[model samples]
Target: MDARITKAEAALLLPATTIPSRRLAEVEAIRLAAIAARDEAVADGVRRAGQAMLNAAEALVRALVTFPARIDTYRALRRLSDRELRDIGMTRFDIPRVFDPSFATRAANDSPQAPQRAA
Candidate 1:
């Protein structure tokens, strides 16, 4: 009753916050943009990873398809005389490793070879 509060002072004393609406909206916009960018980058990385997996799968499939031929070569080598096999720098035990596509190349290189045939 004495020194009564003004309408504006009463409004200021209410529970409502004083943060500017435009500033809040700008901050929210920046956070949303960052989230969207992160989502996009993750999606792109996933897509690339999927593509790499597909490529590896295709290569494995191709290797599987060629397995029979490798086996045939091994059989042919197995049937060869030891002398013949040795001439190619291989022993009977070497056939499987040699014909296997996944064999380490260094092992193959170090394996003995048949002498070069003259032209």
Candidate 2:
């Protein structure tokens, strides 16, 4: 047997080396694709979180901007007499409950003094 390989032998061996290299390239491609997918998921999560924070901030700003108007309305309502309040389906006691979410329901259910409007 010869110690040196001929060109024909080297050519035949080339495919053997290339097969493993091709497999390595395919594995690298799959790994890169997985990494890209993970990064995209993380980016989407961050975007959603940022959007949620922005929505909360907008709501807070809206509340702050409307606070003085709400206070003014409360004061105006407070200045009304019992007759005026009754006509409007409210009472001096109901003034503090104006900001409560259940105020309308509670008022409708509870206030016997609330005048019935003509149909």
Q: Which prediction has the highest TM-score against the true structure?
A: 2
Please tell me which predicted candidate would have the highest lDDT against the true structure.
2
| lDDT of candidate 2 at residue 87, scale 0 to 100 | 72
Query: 25-98, model 1: which lDDT tens digit per residue?
Result: 78889999999999999999999999999999999998899989877887888899988877666777777777
Model 2 Cα lDDT, one tens digit per residue, 1-119: 86999999878877553565878888889999999999999999999999999999999999999999999999999899988887777778889989877885664435866545589
Backbone N/Cα/C clashes per model:
2, 0
Work out the TM-score per prediction: 0.59, 0.60
Q: CA shift at 69, candidate 2, in angstroms? A: 1.0
Off by over 4 Å in 2: 1-22, 100-119
How far residue 96's Cα lies from its native spot in candidate 2, in Å, is 3.1
